[model samples]
Target: MTDDAPNSSTPPGLLPAGLMDLLPPEAEREAVLVETLMAAFAGHGYERVKPPLLEFEDSLLAGSGAAVAEQTFRLMDPVSQRMMGLRADTTPQVARIAATRLGLQPRPLRLCYAGQVLRVRGTQLAPERQLPQTGIELIGSDAPAADAEVALVAAAALAAAGVPSVSLDITLPTMAPALLEAAEVPPALRQRLARALDRKDAASVAALSGEAGPLAAALPVLLAAAGPADGALAALAGVELPPAARAIADNAAAVIAAIRARAPGLRITLDPVEFRGFRYHVGVAFTLYGPGTTGELARGGRYMSLNEEPATGMSLYPDAVLRAAPAPAPRPRVFVPAGTPEAALQALRAQGFATVAALSAADSPKGLRCSHRLVDGRAVPISKEG
Candidate 1:
């Protein structure tokens, strides 16, 4: 073969990095999970909204969407002759719809969405360029109650989706930045300190305290305050923060209080100094984890809508959710012989059996991978030994 010729051993079905075909029950399971989450949101008065997968680059990366700009995949639109981008996340699209399409709607408009997001690259932990997301947004409200509602709704949705032992880790993304600003830390030092805090490097955080001043001293306290909800809240309360940073802490406290009041049994944690992965969150932010999951099952928080309306939302990763959720029992598949009446096949389907009609006499139930077979116009279980 020539040097440029394709390798003969390479599988024709091979996909690019960070992409794959979801097969069989796995695809169905993800679909069901998405619906389960959407149902949970609908039950709480959140209406569903669907946005196009691609949009003009300018609009797609506007406002809060700008946060994911680097991750978005851009291409030129043949018709409009403008740059178009695939969404890296769904929140910005929902925000855009709410601001422009539904701008005249009522306040505190609750909207939910489910879609696939394509990113140019994936994180080391996730490593999936295309991800399915189902989430909700509550726009035009900045109250602590609104924040609590989103968090609570997310927990309830995950529970409904069968994610067991789910824990919510709440963070104040602006807390560390506010502290650095209040301390009058230089721009370069602020960036360094922020990086240290993001990595949870206690030694570096403490080392920078001298130059960061009194307010910076609170950074270490904030870092240590990360833990179970109650204790973390207490530690955060004890720290003397500047006004801006202190207000952020208070808002977090109120939101936590509301959540505790409703879901006292929920496992909640507070990370006051976590400033990473929340580029647009101006207030409280959170991540959801389940037992046995590799990374976060979901993440979201308070952010402004496209029109600057206050909004908070959460997005669940159905792929991770499926890994965390219990595997659903597979539906029985029934094999129908060729020449079976159309009515009989319809009846089998109506009875909840997946009918696989044989095209030839040689096809058997076992060969068709079916658990049952149609005989005498009735569905009967196929014997394993047969």
Candidate 2:
């Protein structure tokens, strides 16, 4: 066969990379998951907000937007004759809403959002360039309680979505950067240290920062202490850090303590030097993972909204959340034969059955996967053999 010839099993209408069409009940499951999460957020007083898919490039790329600018897809707006962008992340849009539209609202605005985001590229772990994210943004508060509250609320939402035995990993992305700055490390060495931390390599961190004096001595300890939360916090407490860096560590400890108080059963871990996906987070950040899952199920942390107001929140990946949830109970489907009384069909629907009306004489209810069929003025279950 020629190189371009399609294989026998390869069907037509192939989708582009990082995109897939959801068919059947899977699509319905996703919608239900989103609604369940939104309801959980609402229970915690986070009002729902929807931002448009496209916005002027300048507004969309401002502040935290700069961190995700590369992933955003840009287009030209015909009316304004200006560049526009399809948002790669909804957090930035929510931040914009807080800063501009909801400017006059009370302090500590609690806002939640659910929407699809389009990215230009995808990572190995998450290949879908199109993603559905549902999250909350707690703006204008930097207290440790705010941090802890968001974490627990996220966990609560996951539980509501039926994700079991969830574990949370909290990371301090700002810790290493602050220590490097305090040590007066140059730009080149700082980049090297960051790369080492990404690999969880303590030896490289020590070697790179060895000449920076006291800060160099503590780098190895910090990297080594990244595991269980209690032990990691104990190790961190002994390290003599600069005043500013120490405060950040203290905030993280407080948040962890608060979470423990609220959810003693929840598993928690700490990583002081993790800096992979949190480019804009300024304080305690977290990622949620579950057993049998390939990548992080959700991620959130403290960051400046609009690069001005302090904000803390988390976003759950709908696809991951659905994967982690128990499979939904099968839907109740019934088939109404042609010439069946309209009242009968209405009664079936009222009785919690999903009715499928017969369009032709040859259409069998069994062929449609219907669990029951209306026959002779009565609804009866379909038999397996017959």
Residue 74 in model 2: shift from native, Å?
0.2
Q: What's the distance in Å from true for residue 334, model 2?
A: 0.6
lDDT tens readout by residue for model 1, 1-386:
78998777767899889998999989999998899999999999999999999999999999999999999999999998999999999999999999999989989899999999999998787788999999999999999999889988988999898875788999988888888888899999988897888789999999987687887898887788799988888988898888998899899999999888898888999988887674999999989899864568889999988867899999988998888888998999998877888888888889888999988879878877999887888888988888
Candidate 1 has which clashing residue pairs, if any? none
Model 1 residue 69 CA deviation (Å) reads: 0.7
Report the number of the highest-TM-score candidate. 1
Q: State the TM-score for model 2.
A: 0.94
Q: Which segments of model 1 are wrong by more than 4 Å?
A: 1-11
lDDT of 2 by residue, 1-386 (tens): 89998767646778779999988899999999999999999999999999999999999988888899999999989898999999999999999999999998998999999999999999887789999999998999988889898888888998898976789999998888888888888888778878887887777878877866677567889899989999889878999899878998899899998899899999999988777675889898899997775367789999998848999989889998887789888777888867777788888888878888889988887788898877775668888875
Tell me model 1's lDDT, rounded to 2 decimals: 0.89
